[model samples]
Target: MPLDELPPPKVELSDDDWRARLTPEEFAVLRRAGTERPGVGEYTNTHTEGVYTCRACGAELFRSTEKFDSHCGWPSFFDPSHSDAVILRPDDSLGMRRVEVLCASCHSHLGHVFSGEGYPTPTDQRYCINSISLRLVPAED
Candidate 1:
């Protein structure tokens, strides 16, 4: 699809504003569309019960119940908090074809989703997300 055919950005901020709002690492990953090193994400081993929200826009992205270990070196969720909570776009960068997941509200690069790996998830798909793009809200007892 052409650039004109694409939807408008969810949230627009000046480069300086984005830089000020996010850390250097976050600005690189979310604004510049970079990826963190595998197995190095903060949420990779987090087993806490909570909802994960967008670090940039505080948009709820995933629920703890949907999380699972895919051993793919990232935070894996079987589903988003809601269908519209995240946006999936075709990413052919780096000479590879994959779906890029972004925060619907702030358009931050969360990560990628992969399928057909035969995970025990209900959707059988892994929503591999970046820890820097998410902030956990622990569930209250």
Candidate 2:
């Protein structure tokens, strides 16, 4: 779905400022690159039609149409809402090699994405995202 309005420009804030604006959990996931327990995210089983924006910066990231049940214990998207909405990077943390997904605007860690573990999506990729890293803005009726 197209965004209702343009994304509030790229966000740049200090650690203190970010901490002040987010809850502990949100801070962990968005700033500290922490992960929530599997299968316990708010958006994992959600079928609401809307756009998912960065919890910290309100930048549009994923759309409901891209969401699908990957049964991977997190919200999964076949692609981002826009190409420039997210930034991908190499993550070698936890002794595993993976591509990490981050909000392009705020550089907050959203999650990791994997490929070749196909689920019949157009992109042939699963953007495994954290629920706390996103805020759903339901579509208008």
Candidate 3:
């Protein structure tokens, strides 16, 4: 989608302020629409018990229980923790069409979701998330 077509992201941060708060890499992936190297994200191999929340705005997006190894070099989930926490947009970048996932609260780019996949879960959905887009909070006992 064209930059002008999509609704303006709900989250607003002053460029300088955001820059000061986030590292160059974080800002690139979170704000500047950049993608980290596949399989290099922190959560790709993370098997800890926790919830994955938006890094920009702590909205719960995924649970560890729904996470699976798609071997797609990203954190894949069969379903989101909550439906209202995410938004999907059609992304046509690099000459390929894909669905882009974003935080509904902050509009931070989370990743993409694909369908028609055989995953060991009820939903045959694969939410390929960027490791940089999430912060894992271990479940408290």
> In TM-score terms, which candidate is top?
1
C-alpha RMSD in Å of predicted model 3 compared with the true structure: 1.8
lDDT of 2 by residue, 1-141 (tens): 112233543788988999999999999999999999999999999999999999999999999999999999999999999999998878888999899998989888899999999689999999999999999999999
Count the clashes in each prediction.
0, 0, 0
Query: Which lDDT values do the candidates have, in the order given?
Result: 0.88, 0.92, 0.85
Q: For model 1, how does the per-residue alpha-carbon lDDT over 1-141 read when each residue is reduced to its tens digit?
A: 323344666777888999999999999988888888989988999999999999888889999999998888889999999999988888898899899998878777899999888999899999999888889999999
Using alpha carbons, what is the TM-score of model 2?
0.92
C-alpha displacement of 31 in model 2, angstroms?
0.3
lDDT of 3: 0.85
Instruction: Identify the superior model by TM-score, candidate 2 or candidate 3.
Output: 2
Clashes of 1: 0
In terms of lDDT, the best-performing candidate is 2
lDDT comparison, 1 vs 3, better candidate: 1
Ranking by TM-score: 1, 2, 3
Off by over 4 Å in 1: 1-6
Task: Tell me each candidate's TM-score.
Answer: 0.93, 0.92, 0.89
Pairs with backbone N, CA or C atoms under 3 Å apart (clashes), candidate 2 = none
Task: Count backbone overlaps in model 3.
Answer: 0
